[model samples]
Target chain A: SVFNVPFTEKSSPGSTPALSDSSLQSDDEEFESVDALEIYDLISSISDPEHPLTLGQLAVVNLEDIQLDDSGNPNEIAEVIIKITPTITHCSLATLIGLGIRVRLERCLPPRYRIIIKVKEKTHQSENQVNKQLNDKERVSAACENDQLLKVISQMLSSCK
Target chain B: MSLSLVHTFTGHTDKCWATSIHSKLPLLATVSGDRTCRVYNLETKRLIVVLDDDSHSKTLSSVEWKPTGEFPSLAIGSFDSTISIWGNEEAVLEDEDNWTLMAIIEGHENEIKGVSWSHDGVYLASCSRDKSIWIWEADDNNEEFECVFVVQEHSQDVKHVTWHQHENVLASSSYDDTVKLFKQDDYDEDDWVNVADLTGHEGTVWSSDFEKKGERVTRLSSSSDDGTIRIWKILHAADDQPSIDSKLPSTIKTDTNQDMWELETILPIIHHGPIYSVAWGENGYIASVGSDGRIVVYKELNSKEWQIIISQPHSHGVYEINNIKWHGDRLITAGDDGLVKLWELAL
Candidate 1:
């Protein structure tokens, strides 16, 4: 079950919490607030490259794993941190999956929002390497430039609704 | 054995959203994020007119030419929640400055995403971010338009609306990850109802176009955010069967009572990114463009399967292609690079 966490309540860093009912209700007036559920809804449907199921269905992205830091001022920049769990301990496509999630959120979310995508610690053997690649701006841009890799990444995201 | 770039029309200062070519005239109309619509002469490759004014305060998303009207006209959809119709004055003697604003249709609450004229040019369909598709009918005598129907079945943003080549049938693709078919009611002149909801795409459907084989709309092609292009065939039920006659035009309505459309083929992983546009060319070809900046053309081989005939990677040099149109035997494409490129099939 997805953990129901309130947006107003502060949780420990890197904690995963399912969005609460209040957060979901605030989505209707999305222009004023950036909720944690909105970020979950964006990346949860992304299809795993090896499986037909989504990242959310495979338990790669849980509601409790999404954290949002919205400055009190709506005009200020907001931060969304998503800690993903690989389907397997040594899943090779974790970085691609993270890139797919990053691309989707970048296209859909407002520019004022900053995104941080990383693999959960101790979830995979190459957690540090994958996290560094995903968060590295130059590495992400270079990876996106590779035609063959982009094709595979696009296929992984094709299942997103 | 490769398609060659024939010409490139560079004028738009912002990302070009859509392109529409005139059926008879050597003209093309393009709309852009710069809040302007440009008309170009294909033969001379010159900008004939620029339809930019303070009236359009937001980006223009789509443009379509009236196929069978008395005078040449263009329908433009903008982000300002309005659709504007421009008509060329027949009585005017000048070549330039003849286009005038015929009407401003304001029904959509949000940005208008697409606008298309029926093959007969008697009706126009517009879809919007408001999750509604509005059908407008023109009154020939008064030159005014009336809203015939408003379809709110799509649960999310409606991205594109297209009409069949030979019938009054309309197809709409939406962010709801579904494509819907709407046909006019036989008994009620003003009524249009949804007949089918195609829901195979796992992502938002970006665009859809019907294939005109001879005089029939035998197939439909849809491009989606899933980076795939799908083909669906229309099937008519047997006369003896009890069919769901949701609504079909009277011209093709037989005793069968029902018509259904089934997914025929899936061109999976055709692009490296989300496909934004797809068009069925008159020369028995299909072209698709996507976020990967590639324009790929396909042709059916032996009526069984489709094969990629031309694959132009980096057609816009890393710029996402938003729309494409078939002008005569040539193809015109617009993209985020603010340039329009034309390609011709290699004979």
Candidate 2:
């Protein structure tokens, strides 16, 4: 029933600057460091499959939840950990959202950056299962290889800048 | 039908946004989000040169080669809101690495989306997120480009700019869900006017190209976020009548009739997601690549109907395909996977 209705702007408290507007900001001149805001910018604008609102507007991706662990050496590999919160406890598309975030980071970031996408603790009903599915190398690759699933994920990310 | 991978160019560090091939040479140039432009030789499957100097600091979006020039010249558009012209002076030189920056045109306030050179290589049209399309004239004697027209008629960001195959006309697609046609004023040689605006797509129009069917019939193909490829047929009017509403200034109206373009047909949904790029191939094949990582080729069965002849799903894995262009029989595609793949139709 929710899918049939067109979502008009009903302001919520979590509404911030839209991801489309913030992502268009020029990158920092300093290329040596990877900022956490950049990671937030990448995933915040992803449209939800159930709702027309962005992840940022739904409070699914917050700047505070993105953590970047660098070795302080530019040549060494860096690790990025993103903790995502689903809008509902029983949201079925959590894994799909996580996959979308993972794919976006993989395309935008360099090879040296290791990405870890996880469901925020207690945010979903099947948090452990969703986390395992999101982080499993073979499972992630297999989901990406699926043409039908990839189409849905692509639609979720189509609104991203 | 099936397709085979010919070659894969793994030079760009990030997503390759646009690609263009030289008219007379075995060269293909591609721009990437890595802020670099790479030119590769199709014959040897080797990279000729990489243009990643200090000139471009942001992502390079589009690149186009001059159709007819004394020497090989390229126009590159970047996210830094500027377009750089690179030229090779020594045409006969064996060295392919002698590319020098000729001019830098800085006018747009935001990212430059697309740059295209006219068929005769006289005019260069570029669109930008600033909702404007600027036309530059090439002064061969001075080796410089002068800004001639800046048309800010689009209500939203202009995504792509393409020139007609046989005329000086230019077509631009925008995020406003419309495609506009512009041509030089018949009465005044110095004035460029917006002749028509096509508004059938319900979502953003990403790319468009002209296909010259015969002597008088010219067709236009456009890909949009609505997940459909639309074909429009261009008809020349015998009398002075505007087919669509004229957004042009009243002073630019002349007594002669202008060309009329009507929506011809809508192709079936080949890709489930948004289609980003559509290119009319040289050998009567239409190739399209989209966000679903699939490249689908369509061919006309009879005089009226078009059908998908070849469908290559997962051509670039899971990443979105940014651009697809046909160089002779081979189809060159670049995408967010950071790989430039060449595909040939399998017999």
User: Which candidate number has the best TM-score?
Assistant: 2
Model 1 lDDT tens row, B1-347: 47689988877766688999888877889888667898888888888788986667677888998987667888999877899998887733236678888889999988788999888888999998789999999765216989989999999879899999888889999878899988887788788878777889977798998986767567889998778999988775232233444366556555343457788887635686578899998787888997767788888875558888788776765356888887666788997656788998785
All candidates: CA RMSD (Å): 15.1, 14.2
Candidate 2 residue runs with Cα over 4 Å from true position: A1-161, B92-94, B215-217, B237-258
Interface RMSD of 1: 17.7
What would the TM-scores of all predictions be? 0.67, 0.69
lDDT of 1 by residue, A85-107 (tens): 99888999888889888877755
How many clashes show up per model? 8, 0
The TM-score that candidate 1 achieves is 0.67
**Alpha-carbon error at B172 in model 1, in Å?**
0.6
What is the Cα-based lDDT of residue A31 in candidate 1? 43
lDDT: which candidate is best? 2
Residue-level lDDT of model 2, residues B174-252, one tens digit each, is 8788998888877776688887788799777889988855533378899987889998887764234555436666566
